[model samples]
Target: MVQHFNFFYDESEHSRKINHSTIVSENYYDNFITTIVGWQTADEKIVLKKYLDFEEKYSDRKSDGELKSTTLKKRQFKNGFASLNRDNIEFILDLFSIFDDNVLLYFSITSKIEYIINQLFLNYKNNIWEDMDMMRYSIVKAIVMYQPEEIISGMYENTGELVQLLKTFFNKRINVNKTNPKLKEHETLAFTQILILLDDINVKFDINWNYDIAFHGFKKYLIEKDISKYSLFLDREGDDGNTLKAAKQVGLTFVTEVDSKEITGIRMADMLVGIISKLLKSLHEELRYDSIEDGLNKKILGEGWFNLNEQQLFLYKQLTHIICEVNNAWYKSFCGIYSDDFIILVSLLNYISSFDTVNEIKAVDKKMHGEHFNAYVCKELESYFGRMESKLPIDPIPGGKKDYFYNQRGAKVFFNSSKQPLLKINEGCNIFNVLSVGFSNDGNAMITISENKNFLCYRLPKELFEWAMTCVAFANRGDNVFPSKVQFTKNGDRYYADVL
Candidate 1:
């Protein structure tokens, strides 16, 4: 025999209680009859009736303390089921199938039903003069059971039926020009919520939802109130601009103006880079794992393949060296900039390089002792610096080999030139903390190369004097030396300096 179960509120506050004795067993057909009968007796229906009665009685009078207390009492009576065990309640509800006639009654006895009831009571309680809460609870209850497939089927079954039903209900209860201002507002918000839920259900069920109808209804709902006025733009056409504009107009103070287009581009770039980096890391891991597995599973390479194996290892090391070189090139390109965004980007790139480098080195170190791996890394570094030097016009002067002197103001300056009357170069004047050399690409620019901040170029003949003065001022400003890159444009008409 199928066991019957029922969960109802036990109002006794002393302990967790359920009125298990109320359980009733009936045939499937009789169960439906019993459920409808029980719903009539339920506190939700009773409270709803009382709320409608109160609206009728107090239609002329202003809301008073006694009326408010009465409303609160009705609410308490409706919400009395809050003490029921939720899990056991769900178990009892599962007895009714989706197509069962008792399904509506099952939902009526659940938590969501209780919530709707309390809300309706509260709505009418506050505004006794309003006609009604518009029987929204009934509509929502119907929607909850409507299910996505049913709605789709219903839409096809009668084209105008759904819209007619909605129109009739909305027209009867919702007053656009109601004297009770709160009632007008609540109804509008409730309508919007219902529309959103309908959209959600359609999307979840993969139905061919009508965006025009949904948004149009939402727009109409918003026009009824000033606070929800910005919701009008939610249906507006265009890019993300409409949504952003609406957010701003609604006094959504926390939404920031970070240049949506630029932010989106940056985010996409970051995602792409991150994906590539992960792929590279995965490849490296696979190579190392295969090498270890091969060594364990098979015999060591014969003398014929010894040279091939050595060459393969050599090629792998060279590939890593190339990766490092490319990273260095990227670093050099942006090193002259003072922009915080560029700096952050460079930092992240360097971190990715360092992470990969550390892992590769560790893996190689495991295969060979510290000496072979360390020597290989050093050779790669040497090659990198050699390539850098070949590209630069000025050679690096070694420490102690170069002459250092203090000016009349007692500021130290390092000179490679063995000439008298040393020119005073301020810290900011040295682009990327490197001495300014003749401009590259043309005479329209000057370049300063340094490892810490990289290159600084000052563009044009016009801004040279001002750049010089600014550098001198920075020198006189005491201990905090500014490192920057100054670049001159090709026309010599403008000068650009990376000074932050």
Candidate 2:
């Protein structure tokens, strides 16, 4: 049997990068990283077991009740991961050890500044200013670098007002001022040209620019991965209306949003992204953290942070030593650093490649390292995700077949909302994630019928839902109260679910 893939995606944002550029007065840019950790579905159980075991054994027993990388103090690693206290350092190594040879990684780093500048100029590609993409970028770069601070503080709310602001600012700059200390002489003309060009266009501002481009980048990576069948579970607070449509374009067989708290894979992704982002930062600059705190921001580098035991002290180094060979399918790495100011990316990759284990960083050199460093990774990702596979399981419905399915021997149910019955049948490893009791769509509640694929809703008629859930007594119970193993089977056009 051909094995499919399961991917868990997690994303995080760090402090804005302060660029000492010759362009803007306040050159602050937001840094965002999205990590997709993938493994063969066949090995999903094994990979998940590793995370669970480590969390049980090594979690710091913090009151937050999560063994998350976010909880790890930065001051603990104020010097580097090497300085992380023993307990957390052990967590890091043991956490990653879950992958074995079955895991794959695709990470992309982008910035809001890059997203705005490139997208702003993308429209002018066929216009007279098309050839001057960089000049156009520089013109807008200096203006939006501070982002809703200087010129665009309230411009986003109303485009007409935005245009007026731009018109007022650019008219003065072009006719009266004739020069900006930030922008060069020719860029001044470029700025004036952009303002005039905006008049012909709708001039829309995309609030979801970063996420849209990030998904596009992810889509590109998955396509290059050449995997025919795959399921993606992402941990996010809300839904991206167009993301589902966009993700389907990449031939995803299954996709769903999972709570990181419950999904081991998402939790692992959270840790992976957290560590890698800081790892990159550590590689780029010397640590100058504030004095350690009560794990707040000071006294931050305490014994509990990274003061690891002698045996586990090598774990941090173990991370740096992991082989990043280009041919290694076990871990395919991609870096989508926006190119214009890719020096930081290059310097980090330069250091990564210095170790024979980091061939992954070099993969971006040609794409992100051209002279002006202006080729954005979004384009590279967009180009890579060009082809689609023919004749495959397009979107496999969970448990669509007629068969008797049994939940795990001991399963737990959890609730997300207090107002209504929105049940999550977390069979330990997230087997049956559906079962809504209060839903009254067409005189029925919703119950997901599936084992390990996209959720397929099986609307239980009010009669059956009431009868079955009463046997289960799901309504009155609190979170994680259900501990019975239930069996579900489809008979003809009707479905039968029994609480066994």
Candidate 3:
């Protein structure tokens, strides 16, 4: 049977807004979260009952009201959540028990601003409360959803603006190197890459995507795993033609605008992402603690505020209850630049077990010696676990070797002296190969006569050709050898040749 599942996806992020310039070393709260929860279509009836029961017991709030973590953080809900019947730990436990075997969860978490600044260029709108987050998310979604051609076609009108913004940011006068003398090689490369990304699309369309990279990674993972044929019922954000286009791009067969109040699964997904965002914040703070020995453990062991251990313990327990284990729920980070403080601890869950596991199997071969098994796997696991990559260039040295000729950007000048007149091949003597061994092939040679602007091709015997190749190789290796002239013996007569 092609099992039908209903997936509810939502996002949560930190409420506070901080600009790049305003960030202080002491103030640290930056995280964005995307959550997706799914269950079999047949299990909706029981799921509704579980949510209704919990609401009736603990909250005077109706099922239609928003059950966000921020709203739940109010004194009334917090007090009721800590009541004898429904304490904070038991509340999550109860929610977990409702859909134990029938549900699946996945989430991605990263610093939102960090992701924006590094991945997509930040757009400064007057209102900080504008849908900037959603816009950022949409661009990343579009990046992942369509190829460069498709995106250029879909968003053609914006290309000029994008190009202008890039030019202004990089301070480049022109795109081509032949025209502009002061263009940096890396900047040129970046420009070329952007141009390629904006090249060639005949079709034209538009999309308004409210969810960004959080959903980008989630939908991408689904597409990768071949489990994309699900009914995506998101709590209604807004409907636009772009949403449908994006949905079609990601292989989602059906899309439904769900009411957060009506669908308990949708509301639950909202609550879950919110709580996960909070947990991620706590985890990040724990990671940032400078003096902590066991990095990820300091938070779990509760060296700080009330019930911090309980919070960490309950989060794992509830996750375990939902999917039977905290490690089983798929987790990924979509932020372009990730932090290095806790290299292995950014897996949506704050727990250490959320880190990826590697299987190291050693097999002994009869002919294999000391380095045999090491070469087999090539220390793949060690390399993966050792260091995380940065999105920005790490310690880049400016001004590459390619711009040394005439002090302009072009191919590197290997040999730079002067060229001699062209040497013609003799009649009935076939020209064989064209070798490109030149320190400055810009019509120049390190050893030359009379500063002529031409190069000579000498017809050499096979032995002489081998000698020439050896000499070129040595010259390339920085050996101080330059030929002033050449003389070859022909039929017991010496034929002399000069560079001119």
Candidate 4:
């Protein structure tokens, strides 16, 4: 019988404070990390023994004999790992080298607060923007559904207080502007209440989101390598086991829980978890974060975010390389073979890369170096357009506009709402309805129609083109379906699409 590959999984978290909070206040971002370690069952004994030897050499906990990531800090070397700073680094590097030799590693990180805020504000829920029907239930579900069990149970225990707070938060009008003091205070308190109510929702979202991504990555590896069966081991503590159900939902067949003390693979995961947590913090600190936090007024990552010392840079390169390499490998296996949905992602990423100059690059480099290295990692790690920032500049490609109205400047044009972006290509096709919806990428959302050919483009902002990709029809041979009629309309910040 062929021996199956066994996988071990673990998670880590880092909470970074973005704003000053007193004892009474609470506002910060919780970044979540999940790492998966996998190896063949035949190597289990060797892997476990290697873990034990490494623990014996570095760990100070004799009774527990399990290496905890929290104790692996550089400053805690005296009482924890019992090695010099450089030695501790080398120890982890050596351990990761072992992992590289024997096991496949993958991780998913999410900044919890960022996701929460985006779901709350930029999404249609705030109602400051468009009143699209799809957004109606989304706000309620995003808030109510993802509550942590503890928060839900606690609310049940104090139903009266919870009800009153909910009533207060809902009844108050949320003013977008801050010129009026009373309205501003009301909005401020309302937001604070919402945050308090959803205190644990962030963690729950983080767990689900990160778990789903990590499992997907692992599954992709299995499929690409043609491995049919594998056993999964998750640390039996906390929410680590919470994702087992999710794994099953995603077609994972075998999973079991193992205590960190009993399994060396999980111990290795524990170390990587901690190391990654630290690296996240160091990476954030290395950047000119003020511009990232405030605005892009100053040069982004110009002061050398990726310009790192040798050791620090090596670790950064190694970890990011592992993620991108693993993901890109999976992407390559199917994207070129089957023309996957990720073809859009490739197009978008290529579009972003086109913006690179002599000094800046948008995507994370495979080696985690080169121009704008810091910007690349930051974009990879953060939400697509979270509260911290807006969409990057996407300048229009000028040659596409052959008609006169498509070249119109500074005019408001609206179209009937449609489902997907309208794409048409032909020689000398320059006759149709022309409406300038809005300016994006310094170009209007213009519509052009010709005899039996309708090309509708530029409805939403360029950032939204990503969401419209799946709906886009690529004009190719064999079978062609083009929208006969399309409409694009913008109501405040919301853009709508309809097709007929």
Q: What is the lDDT, from 0 to 100, of the residue 207 in candidate 2?
A: 36
Report how far residue 82 has shifted in candidate 2, in Å.
6.4
Candidate 1 lDDT over 243-316, as tens digits, reads: 33544454442333333122222221222222222322222222221321132221211122111222233332
Q: What is the lDDT of residue 203 in candidate 2?
A: 56
| RMSD in order of candidates | 34.9, 20.6, 20.2, 15.0
Q: Candidate 4: list runs displaced more than 4 Å.
A: 1-3, 14-29, 61-63, 74-84, 114-217, 238-241, 285-321, 324-328, 331-471, 474-500
lDDT of 3: 0.42
lDDT of candidate 3 over 313-424, digit per residue (tens): 4545455344335324233334433332112223222232232221111122223322332232234423532322111112211222343232122222333232222333
Query: Which lDDT tens digits does candidate 4 get at residues 1-500?
Result: 55588878887653322222311133112455677777788877887787778777775644455567766563432211212357655765666655545666655555443343343333232222322222222223223323333323333344434434443433332332244545246334544455444433322111113245346556665655546668888888666455676677677888887788887778777777676555444333323224212211222223233322345335434544444453344322211111111222222233233432423432345244433433554454334223212211122222222322232333222333243244332233223343323233334333333333443443444544643442322211111133344454555555555544
337 in model 4: Cα distance from truth in Å? Answer: 25
Q: What is the lDDT of candidate 2?
A: 0.49
Whichever of 2 and 3 has more TM-score, that candidate is 2
In terms of lDDT, the poorest run of 10 residues in model 2 is: 387-396
TM-score for every candidate vs. truth?
Answer: 0.16, 0.50, 0.44, 0.46
Which is superior by lDDT, 2 or 4? 2
Ranked by lDDT from best down, the candidates are 2, 4, 3, 1
- Error (Å) of candidate 1 at residue 67 is 72
Q: State the displacement of the C-alpha of residue 497, model 4, in Å, after optimal TM-score superposition.
A: 22
Number of clashes in every candidate structure? 12, 17, 5, 11
- How far is 366's C-alpha from truth in model 1 (Å)? 7.4
